[model samples]
Target: MLTKKSLIGLTALGALALNAVPAMAQVTAGSQEVHAYVGETFGDDLTDRRISGRTPELDDDVTYGLRYGYNFTDAWGLELSLGQTNSAVTGLPGRDIDLDLTTFDVDAVYHFNPSGRFVPYVVAGLGYASADLDRPIIGAVNGGSVRIGDDNGFTANAGVGAKYFVTDKVSLRLDARYRYLDKVVDRFDDSLNTFETTFGVGFHF
Candidate 1:
């Protein structure tokens, strides 16, 4: 039986398939893609610890970014993505701690139908994530800016998405991914996870 996550992926891919239309030019080898996208990120707990005075949560927020990809073959490609989010650090009373996050990833992609107008693909990658804390914890001894994740804790992700050529050189894209974070905070478990979905326009060259 398909798990819940699998079902969700299938549903998203199905929608892309339904939008398939003949394209003026296919995603041929040596093709490059530049896309500008906006999406939502569902927040995840930064840590399992609920200690008093230790703030350990991130809130859901909107994200925007750009992606660049180069196809080496009709079926294989690599992409570099950069995104940013303005979200709050929850679990703090009286008010939330606002923070800004910057994320980068390099993913390898496999297209199911590079020749089709609606092309669905699977992606996996490793990357880095960092956050800028607005300020230090309100009441901590020897306080300093809190680090968002372990210095060595690397970020990894896997997801599925699709693209539909709207015109000869312009295309519409949809993507959804789950990111597994390294330790979110010092001394806390790094098993944090976040969900993201985006829609964008792509320019093929």
Candidate 2:
């Protein structure tokens, strides 16, 4: 009832039909998203080996950040962010160790309610950060007042956030995140850590 050519053609047609089923079932959340935001970093601290042979503490103050992301599907996406903060070395009263920090990160994100007006997401990422010490307390150990030596390291963070869509193209976003980084000075045993909160507007296309 069938020729060889007909059998081959039918088999090819069946394969194409099967492939089309999956293609038709696939759904995408959005192609891309960009956001600009300003926020504050809190609960940030550092420990460093001091000239007195004891570890001294530093505290981070206000912070600001911006982020951009791409979505592969309704539930999966990737993001990149940049942030900056100011800090001061504590426990050393007279000596000023003004520090400014900058960080860059890339993350994988998941949206639990991608199709809803309000979407909740979780994000985790790997990053790099640098601390600029404005005034060097140890001149011989560090070269200049803006000591960048031993102030750069690997970083990591994780957080939760939500987006409330006001329209098809715009949304309001709020997030809180925490990060951990390697110590600036080798002798310090504790790693640096920070917690931050942010609110911003996002656009999707």
* Best candidate according to lDDT: 1
Give the clashing residue pairs of candidate 2, or none. none
94-142: candidate 2 lDDT, tens digit per residue: 5757777788999999988687777899999998988777765442224
Model 2 TM-score relative to the real fold: 0.73
lDDT of 2 at 139: 29
Model 1 pairs whose backbones collide: 183-190
Off by over 4 Å in 2: 1-30, 43-45, 48-55, 138-150, 185-189
Output the worst ten-in-a-row residue range by lDDT, candidate 2: 18-27
Alpha-carbon TM-score of each model against the true structure: 0.79, 0.73
What tens digits encode model 1's per-residue C-alpha lDDT throughout 113-175?
888878999999998887666764343223443333333356888999998886557777899
lDDT of each: 0.75, 0.66
